[model samples]
Target: MLVLTRRKHQSIMIGDDIEITIAAVEGDQVKLGINAPKHVEIHRKEVYLAIEEANREAVSDVARVDLKRIMGQLGGSE
Candidate 1:
């Protein structure tokens, strides 16, 4: 992991697209301002993790379902 110290109003660039700026600092909390293209997705780490976990659970639930039995019940063409 790369660690860099930035003071308020300082900015960092990612590749040629994204920019992160320090907007404010108060006590131990720091506020950030981000600039990026609309196609780029940005999320807080915890929120991202939650989304990933939910996707995994959805996939697992689908895998556990008896699709063949449901198709038979619906009179699907075998």
Candidate 2:
């Protein structure tokens, strides 16, 4: 991992589009301001991990569904 120190209002750029700015520092907590395009998704590390875990769980649950039963209930060849 790349580690760099930036004071409040200082910014670090990633590629041409993403910028992360230090907005405030209070004791052990630091607030950040990110500037990026709408297509870009940004999430806190913990939140991202939780979302990833949730998605994996959802996918696993879907795999266990009874496809034949669903098809039987829906009927075939509309």
Candidate 3:
């Protein structure tokens, strides 16, 4: 993990475009502002986890095919 200390109003640039800035600090919580191109997606860790989990469930449901349904669609004996 690349950890650095940044005070309010200071920023760190990433690569050629992305920038992360410290907006405010209150006790143990901090607010940050990110600047990036519209094509780039920035997601919080928990949000990503939830999206991944939902995708996994959908994929698994599709993978668990009903053999009977397939045979009926094919007009073949089960």
Q: Which 10 consecutive positions of candidate 1 have the poorest summed lDDT? A: 63-72
Alpha-carbon shift of residue 27 in model 2 (angstroms)? 1.2
Q: Tell me the alpha-carbon RMSD of every candidate.
A: 3.0, 3.9, 2.4
Better of 2 and 3 by TM-score: 3
Displacement of residue 39 (Cα, Å) in model 2 is 1.1
Would you list the C-alpha lDDT of every candidate in the order shown? Answer: 0.93, 0.92, 0.91
lDDT of 3: 0.91
The Cα error of candidate 1 at residue 25, in Å, is 0.4
Off by over 4 Å in 1: 66-78
Candidates 1 and 3, the one with greater lDDT? 1
Question: Candidate 1's C-alpha lDDT?
Answer: 0.93
Query: Clashing residue pairs, candidate 3?
Result: none
Cα lDDT of model 2 by residue, 1-78, tens digit: 999999999999999999999999999999999999999989989999999999999987787676766887789655
Output the worst ten-in-a-row residue range by lDDT, candidate 3. 62-71
